[model samples]
Target: MSDRQAYSGMAVTGIDAKGRAAIPAFLRAALDRNGAESRVIIAESANAPCLIGFDPAYLEANRAKYGSRADARLDAGETVDANAARLAFALNDIASYDSSGRFVLPPFPAMKAGLDKTGPVLFAGLGDTFEIWNPELLEADAKVHPAFKERALFCLSQWKKGGKG
Candidate 1:
């Protein structure tokens, strides 16, 4: 990915002694430009056993995109987009990056995101946001559907090779 982009490329990083994972240097710089300094909004991914990280600006945008009716809908005892509500709730946890460009993953959220502090973790960038995943979990799921795995990986490869995707 180019230096001018939002976030892209991928890596396998290790969680440190303090349950911290370093955001890739390139991504960090991008985050800075995008108005996220030492802090970021992290949440359990809606459709994956992983953690999703993005700038607070995106969170605000998300709230607006989903419209101002979310709260009203919930108050009416209606079934709203649960995932969006989940994402909205996740905004309560604002994560901070250390001097070394790492962010601590609280134990509860880490466990929920499928990390057990014993294996390499995958970092996948998806433009507006990025994800941290247990590599084995992602790999195992990839095996469940041939087309899904192939298409996803092919797109990832292209993005890593400098395509916009």
Candidate 2:
């Protein structure tokens, strides 16, 4: 909506024993359009049991928004919570992918997102950011939309049947 390249579509990919996963081609194209580098900030989603990935531009936009809000609160004689701001950025990990779109997920963020060390990872695009989900975790999440839950289940079934997720 703001002229930013939106992340769209969904893909299910495998994560190896060492937490390596490839960004799907569609999402990679969107990232390329938004940033000069093949790097993204992967963070635990505040509202879901999953990880969220966004390009540097998105992170900068968020930083600007946070700064403006903090300034406004200060102008209104309100205390700015420096610790809160620090925590928000501290939990994120910057991951750089190769030309093939392969990147290693940091152990902490991967665990926080409920991703298994080796399993299928579901990438769901949600406009500004995309979600990295452990298909099983996603299937078990009651808060996820019914359609997404169905999709996750379907992907898992396909993976179990020796099909690409």
The numbered model that scores best in TM-score is 2
Off by over 4 Å in 2: 159-164
The stretch of ten residues in a row with the least summed lDDT in candidate 1 is 142-151
RMSD per candidate (Å) reads 6.3, 1.7
Clash count for each candidate, listed in order shown = 0, 0
Candidate 2 residue-wise lDDT, 53-75, digit = tens: 99988888888999999999999
lDDT tens digits, residue span 1-165, model 1: 234357786766667667887877767876788778789777877687788888777777777867668767878898787776665764446889976678888677788877858545667778989887776577677433565445445544554565632
- The parts of candidate 1 lying over 4 Å away from their true place are 1-4, 67-87, 90-92, 143-165
Cα TM-score of candidate 1 = 0.72
TM-scores vs. true structure, each candidate: 0.72, 0.92
Question: In model 2, what is the error at residue 111, expressed in angstroms?
Answer: 1.2
